[model samples]
Target: MPVDAVEVGDLLLVRPGALVPVDAVLVSEHAVLDESSLTGESLPVERVAGERVSSGAVNGASAVTMRAVALASDSEYQQIVRLVEQAAGSKAKVVRLADRYAVPFTVLSLLIAGVAWAVSGDAVRFAEVLVVATPCPLLIAAPVAFLGGMSRAARHGLIVKGGGTLEQLSRVRSAAFDKTGTITTGRPVLDRIVAAPGFDEKSVLQFAASAEVYSSHVLAKSVVAAAKQQGYALLEAREAEEIATNGVAAQFASDATAAVVTVRVGKPSWLREFAPTLAPAPLEPGELAIYVAVDGRFAGAIVMRDQARGEAGQALHDLRLLGIERTLMVTGDVAATAEPIAARLGIDEVHAECRPSDKVRIVSAVQPRPLIMVGDGLNDAPVLAAADIGFAMGARGATAASESADIVNRYDTLASLPLAVRVGKDTVRIALQSIWLGIIISVALMLVAAFGFLPALVGPGSRRSSTSSRSSVLCAPSDRARSGVRIIADRHGRSCGP
Candidate 1:
């Protein structure tokens, strides 16, 4: 049946690896679900009968039955979609900066032309005044400066989609970031190894990696990769058994000792049967510890975590220096997992446990107009479209996020964001300078024409010369702006030009 036809109280069958169609109460006695997309939790959750599993969570392993508790439109996933549409609809159209001055300048020119005609009763004088007061500078200068900025940003590994987005970036006062893949590396990595007494760290890691090599879990891959990275020679295991959502057990033949070694690598509770007194190491807020057992005896633990990026702290510091008044961390991860990272990165605020809708609301409510939202997930797509400026970490980010973002960081680093801001500011400055230069020269020529000092017969030639001079002045700033951007990028040890 179509999801639209799913009503409350309807019984639904969710197959393994399939998404739950709607917010539902579990009908099966036991089930496992991967809620990472909805909740940002790295680990799968176990639910029993009567538990409400949210829509969009991936059912794990076995087929399960659930009773629909909400209509499809009112489900969690649809709510996010609705919020995105609403937010996108509410976005104010971007008005070109040059247009703001064009109206006033045009009105003033018409008023001057009318007065000149009235005072001298000469139609040629009014025409001369109007010709010299043309708003060419307003039309030409801003776009050229913005294009130059966009090109410069592209060279620095930032893709700014439009001139207006670049302008908004220049004026950003606040910034919000998604935790996973934005502030931290999205995948788990082995942090450290704690070996039990009489067991060395190398042996513990080797045994665990050997067993985990046969298990298909995200954490297992990290462990195997870690062991291989350290050049640990893996032994062949005979009869490796993987217990779903628990751990893996394997028996390895020892080449040197001429004996069989049994190893267990998994959760503490799962390993407790073999190592009754298993004592796993203490974990930090965002860390996960997988216990290891060698020949039925407890053998240390391998601690792994989604480590924050090395450049994260420096990037936040640079943004603060670049006039970003407030920085916030908005994530679907829980507060306990998010707070430490936020404090470490010096973020001003932390809004944890956010659904996609919650993220949109939080980012939308952030004070100071022109806020920037940086994210890299499917869940971030809606909020990305909603923010004043959305920056997607595009190198490894979700396609939806990249599509909705106004600016994309192609280098897989946050360093481009500050560079983008600097470029925007410089570009806007150069554009205003060009506009004013054109305005001043045009006004001076208009005054001469209005005073009858410049003849009507010579008016077209003078206007051409004046426009040529204004073009030269306007073009100079683009080159200077490029040089300034290069200097700024160089100061930050980045290449900002072709």
Candidate 2:
């Protein structure tokens, strides 16, 4: 079927082993969906009637009938594809100073060899100098060092997209973080269940979880999970309606109550707007709280809070010691919610209530240039592409953010960011050292050849000296030095910054 011709509410038959055509609500009693490609879930999800299934999911053994909720261009999969194209394509190609250094030395070698041949009136003299003066260090040493650095970084569980990302990391002056998932654990757990005068805590929670279970929002999942953990049985909700930018409404089938009752879950304002007869409870000091309404009355509220990552503070401290001039946090969360976390993490600046465009604008205004942005949400994708270097939390991060990033921390830690910079600087330094070593020895041999000293083959210690120089330059710097290079860890336990 043509994607453009697929209209909303059109019925589409999805066969087993085929990709879902569009974002559709399932009409079948049950459909096993493999959403690893879209949502990165490891196991298959069993979705039933009234559940929305996204495009790019592989159908299971049975055929499924679905009603299209969105067109191809407006779908979640298409949105992610656009982000990947923009993020990967927008970055400018980086040029290495080490590669530029080789150009001038090549010219110098040619000039010295040419002069020797012309003055001596022997083409054989030029051949002798050329044989000794071959620039193997420029050709072999730098690329090997860079490759070594990449491998070392991989051992630490980071995936640097290319050599350019390492080069960018080396000179980074500032770093900005996204507060929710990057600095704090993205998971917000339910903390307190505050119920109204007439309602009990358990009853309100059960009703709220039952209604919220139908939503795909992150908060909804948390509510359902918390209810399950507390041993509350979730009832089957009929005719569930998720109001646009508001609350979810459903008629709960409960054995405890004789009649079917209306239940709602969402923000207080949203609940009030959707159900005018329902009264909303006042909000307390938290961001992750959701209100619940039973029938036409206020039932209670569920408060949730996010925890800061264990390694977060230490990573910020390491970044400063790694010679980053400034560190900041940018988030869409309010000042009250964002500032306390920023203070705990030791961030120098904070930009609260930031939109995706606001984040890009903030990055452009950052002083001294060469900024790095670290984030893990789908909303952070655009700014990740805009920054000089972007580090994505790849373990449980959004696909769009990961694809947009220059460096992806594959594990659930930020410790590798500083290490990557150190390795890149060291690689460049070692490459230069090797190149100069080869050039100096080659020039001395060329000078000796100018005199036609002994013969080209009989120069004292020449072969031994060349071999020794190659070994020192080509090998890694540590215990694995024979095979690879590691970050040069000094006595102070601090990375030697660029």
Candidate 3:
């Protein structure tokens, strides 16, 4: 338990390598905190000069002073602490068929004992019958089988949340994947360099790449990579500045006076925010448009595209073998960008330009059968939670995604997907086997009790009752011969046998 702020008066001390336990304000200017826990970011960010810091995040780089922003009771980390506490306190609710049948079976045994005692005056015989009639099924097989399946699943790189998620996965008939970073590499890359008449592609790429040096946008990386691949010598840039939502501006050594070159990379709306009259045709399919300008005159545009992941096709094949009837790729990217990747991966369905709510809508429409959504992005969070069984791939970088998903594949191996599906089927198979085994043993007990030879105890007037009400307890291996399940426990009260 964390100490409450009111009790601790006003101040709390946090040292290097220690996680901040409360949300606070940065009193020291140079404080840097690692927010990977909440944001899934790989890098640490400088929290300087009155920035709000969240609790449960680690302090990084430099040490600084902090003032508590959220009280102990109101901290976000407290919610995580409370959830873990709740899951720990929650008990397993699983019970075998015999235990479920215990109450009614015991009642019937008592009534039969009352009649037998009244008719033959054999109270000791009634007690003996009840003792032997206890159902062995509930006491033995079911728990062992479930535990065995859990162990097998853990061996694979999949984490099954519980029996419920295991059951859901076994029934899944369809699979939905997020496009960017899922089917294809999420990073954009240089695919083509088309220069307008009179300008060579090499000369244009040199200007574009050099101007992009001042910007960190994904499009900028694509331009830079193209220049490097072509071995173009980039000219030096002067007075470079990136205008948000518009483009990048820089001075270049050119004949035109006021030779200010601006490189525009995003959507038309974003571009036209600065160059209001510079509306290019609606973006073409499968192409990311980046406009270049020289001296306030439109130069031309360079197009790029995201590439598909190497193992995507093989992953799709494995999923098909695992019995996924339909595999769909849904993404916010344009169809031109998403379609080629989908075709390469042999995806059965494709839904592009999707909003987060749209992803949920499509998932909800999945033919009323169980569906699995695989993703690793903040935008994918809603759909991940909405799916019947969500699997998070590449959990090392995205812990929020891993925690949000029902099953997390830690190694990010597409090969592990089929293994996860098999684990689900195996878990269900084991559970069913245990359930049937319990039923068989309970049936045998019912047969024995029907003979009026099993012991029973009567509770009311003129009634004989059983001394023990063990719903299912077996003493010998022969007792479970027909049950297809065995229980072996040491003197320490631990179950060991199959």
Best candidate, TM-score-wise? 1
TM-scores of all models? 0.83, 0.62, 0.52
Candidate 2 has which clashing residue pairs, if any? none
Poorest 10 consecutive residues of model 2 by lDDT?
Answer: 473-482
Q: Name model 2 segments beyond 4 Å from true.
A: 1-5, 8-71, 74-90, 115-123, 190-286, 290-302, 332-336, 352-367, 458-498
- Model 3, residue 348: distance off in Å is 3.2
Compose the digit string of candidate 1's lDDT tens values, residues 1-498: 999999899999999788888999999987878766567675557888999998877787678999999999998777766766777777777787887888788788778878888899987677667656756677689999999999999999998999998778778999999998889887788889999999998999999999998886556778999999999998899879888667889999988997998999988998889888798698988788999998889999999888788899988998888899999999999899899989988999999988887888888889987899998876887899899998999997766688888998998888887888899889988999999999988788878888888664455423222233434222222222322344222322333232
Candidate 2 residue-wise lDDT, 1-498, digit = tens: 788799999999998767887899999877767654443232346787999998877786667799999999997667656655665476566787566766787677678778988999976666556556656666677777778778888888888778767667777899998877678776677768888879899988899898887765446777899899999999898779876445588997657766888898876777775546554445443345688887778888887777678788888888888789998987766677778888888899899877666777787679865888988766577778888888888886777788788888888766766776677677666766887887788688878877677344443322322333323222211212223335543343433221
On TM-score, who's better, 2 or 3? 2
lDDT of 3 by residue, 299-368 (tens): 5567675566677778779878878999898776667667777787789888877755577778878874
- State the RMSD for candidate 2: 11.9
Better of 1 and 3 by lDDT: 1
**Which regions of candidate 3 are displaced past 4 Å?**
1-157, 193-214, 222-284, 290-302, 333-340, 393-404, 411-415, 434-498
